[model samples]
Target: MRGVVVAAALLLAAAGAAQAGPDLGNWRVDAASDGQVTASLYATNKLITGNGALGYSPVLTLACRPDGEPRWSEWLQLNDAVSASRKITMSVMVDGTSKFDESWSVGPRGKLLVREGDDGIKRLVSANRLLLSWRFGLLSGRGEADFDLAGLSEAVGQIAASCNTDPP
Candidate 1:
């Protein structure tokens, strides 16, 4: 019984130590096959009231390219299927300030690619929270999601350094 108790205490200590090391809550960074570094974060709050709902939280991704026409790109992956090759109005608030409320093009896979040279990227990098709301036509209804930008700056800095691009 004494040996078993000691082993359990050691295991608990190990688990605590593992949780303490450089934890990026709700954020992921991955490297693509073509030398692109991408950092993504899942929304803390999800909207799932529409038809065929999957209850999936939206994803916000920022990609930095080593060699490409556009050095960087930002994308918002929605939960429902969106009409591709069309523009949709998306409203974004960063740190309680309305940054942008304009039309953005919807790309393949229901991902909305933010327009190039938008100041929203700069605002997002320095924001602590972000709220996004959009409507995918009448059939799809409306959807909104909020993200906790806890470690976003660090993730973006890592991607920027890896791709040799400026941090937004």
Candidate 2:
């Protein structure tokens, strides 16, 4: 069941990127019959520019299930191409308003992404909109990704319901 949900999330993300322009156009939610939900945020070069080869595209995947808390993961196509310093700073803007500003160390292989945990996930799911910006020093540039929270509220509610709990 978990594998199916994960595959669905990946499929939704890939299809969305092909359909959605480079902007915040690739937000989607997948709810599985087994009470699992996955939300994906995919950004293309059109939305995240200036990273040279390192920022071709990045995808954020959040998976939630009735038996456990949400889990987050990020994949960058050019992770190996990024030569930036290990430390990177990222900021989240909610509806044009600043919300989270923090820094994390990119792993040696450049695979690490800042984890916002349950509180941050709740905040994002509740926001009307949001933007994520990150500085990639190796590229001597930064990239921005946006998200539209149009259907997120209901999606989150449904995900919470799967656990027999209220939306966090």
Candidate 3:
């Protein structure tokens, strides 16, 4: 626990970045299910806590340094109903405003999808902690690559709000 805290601090320092309006504080996940799955998740500043029934033990912890850069990453192991983890790399940009994120996941599953332009909405589904389901252009496939949209959205919002409040 201590090591993770230190590492998170160091990562923020080395990057010298800030997230969205939240100021890059530790956020927690609040989720519930049939005493075995996550149904809701909430993140806070002081503690990145999470409550759920799934095996999603890891909650993304973050720390923002106004003088340095800030970065964070966490893998969510989906069990039963969904099995996936996203390793996202992002930056708060020295100026803070917009954030750029790219993630990759691999698993099993397939479906049909309709192709769309530039920013396409891909639907990823999982029934267990080992297989994954995703929809592409009029087709469905399975692999070990996935993205955490919630995390990305939070990160981007934080930076955007920060910039609105005070630009770099």
Candidate 4:
């Protein structure tokens, strides 16, 4: 019994240490093998429905690859699966200002892939907040998420450095 208690204490400590890894504001950076790093931040506000139903907070993820084309891939992971994998126009607002309605692709597992370009990334790094509104037809319904972009620059810098690529 004493040995078991000691082991349990050690496990708890280890778990705590793991959770204490590097974080910049609401963003969490994770390093994977082969010079890959990912930074993720959850939306500060939940998606509320017209009928007063609340949905889970969406996650914005930035993944850096050392030897992949484009080097970086940005994803908005929705709580529910998208109806289909197709092009959709998403309304974007940065810092409460209307940005643009960009065409985004719904990748596998309902992940919306941000268009590959410097414009989108530039806005993200320089803004304090991001709001995305999309209509996923009747099946998936409409979705809106507001993300807090604090410390996003630092998180991107860390991942860029790890992958030896320029921050996008």
Candidate 5:
């Protein structure tokens, strides 16, 4: 019994240390549809999962070039039960300054790339911050979210390193 307890304590300590190493709380590398590698910020824990039905945790996807320069970014709300074809507008702000504003059409599946193209994703990541807002239902419904761009630079570096791409 004593030996078992000691071994269990050691294992628990090891697990805690491992979780501390990378420290990417909700960010994960997603399989790429195109050549670029992708990392997404999503909640997988039970607390977030429990509230999944309420559409609380939207997925924020960031794609990077092979050389670690940001390629594009996307956001999509998940688990929304309403099946209405709708139009929405998304805006991005950094340091209280609006950087991107675009309209998107969401299908019945509730999946939409809220913003894309040569938007300011690279610049935002370079500056290490993001602020997002969206409006739907003919501007009747709106929401906003903020994020602190901590450790993203290192995360992007890891993506490049994993793919064996030279960092840009």
Candidate 6:
């Protein structure tokens, strides 16, 4: 019984040390086709799930090159020659499950430059612990339901600071 208790204590201590931020909150955002967009992120246990919605106005511009290569810009510029609008839709799940689908090039649209017709890539960074709800591209163009990242981060910081153990 004493050994079991010691093992349990060790596990609990490990868990406490693994927490990313603070609150086990959620982040959901919505963006209209008008060009404006909203992004949100939050902490849940040691995991953080968030949302990033694109809007209609203010347009979500993509001007970055692939692999930070100069040729990437030229390739993307010429990508227009292959397809029309760089319009795309990207979705990310709470468990770091996300996908990106687009026509022409992902660089101009998805921003991650995923293969065409392909859904997206989802990788478990840390034993389902340290998740990365990140996908550079287009999400929703109207609205959505989830937690906000920017706000959640701020909130987590406050909460995590109060905790004796530091949040990741």
Best by lDDT: 4
In terms of TM-score, how similar is model 4 to the real structure? Answer: 0.76
Put down candidate 4 lDDT per residue, 1-168, tens digits, no spaces: 999999999999999998785557889889887777889999887865435566678888888888868777777887566565777788899999856798888887665656554457776897898998888666657788888888889888988888888888
Taking every candidate in turn, the Cα RMSD to the unseen true structure, in Å, is 3.6, 10.7, 17.4, 5.0, 5.9, 16.7
List candidate 2 stretches off by more than 4 Å.
1-26, 31-36, 44-57, 65-87, 104-108, 163-165
Q: What C-alpha lDDT, on a 0 to 100 scale, does residue 147 get in candidate 2?
A: 58
Per-residue lDDT tens digits for candidate 2, residues 20-139, read 632333556677787766666655334334444433346555556666544432322334323455666778788787567866446556654545346666676667766777765554
Listed in order, each prediction's TM-score against the native is 0.78, 0.56, 0.20, 0.76, 0.58, 0.24
**Each model's lDDT:** 0.77, 0.58, 0.28, 0.79, 0.56, 0.30
lDDT of 5 by residue, 1-168 (tens): 999999999999999988776655456775555567766764322112323353365556666554334345455554442233666666777766756776755645654544454354556556545666665345335555566656566666666566566434
lDDT, residue 163, model 3: 31
Model 1 over residues 1-168: C-alpha lDDT tens digits?
999999999999999998875556677999999998888999887667456554778888878789866787778887566654677788888888845786777877665646544255677777799888887667666678789998877888888888887787
Candidate 2 TM-score, C-alpha based: 0.56
Worst 10 residues of 2 by lDDT: 72-81
Model 6 agreement with the true structure over 1-168: per-residue lDDT tens digits: 999999999999999886754453443333335422222233332211223242221111111121222211101111111122454343434434454333334454432222221012112111132222223324422222232232334332343343322223
lDDT of 1: 0.77
Candidate 6 weakest ten by summed lDDT: 71-80
The candidate scoring highest on TM-score is: 1
Please identify model 4 stretches exceeding 4 Å from their true place: 1-23, 48-54, 111-114, 138-140
Candidate 3 segments whose C-alpha is farther than 4 A from its true place: 1-56, 69-147, 163-168
For model 6, state the Cα shift of residue 44 in Å.
15
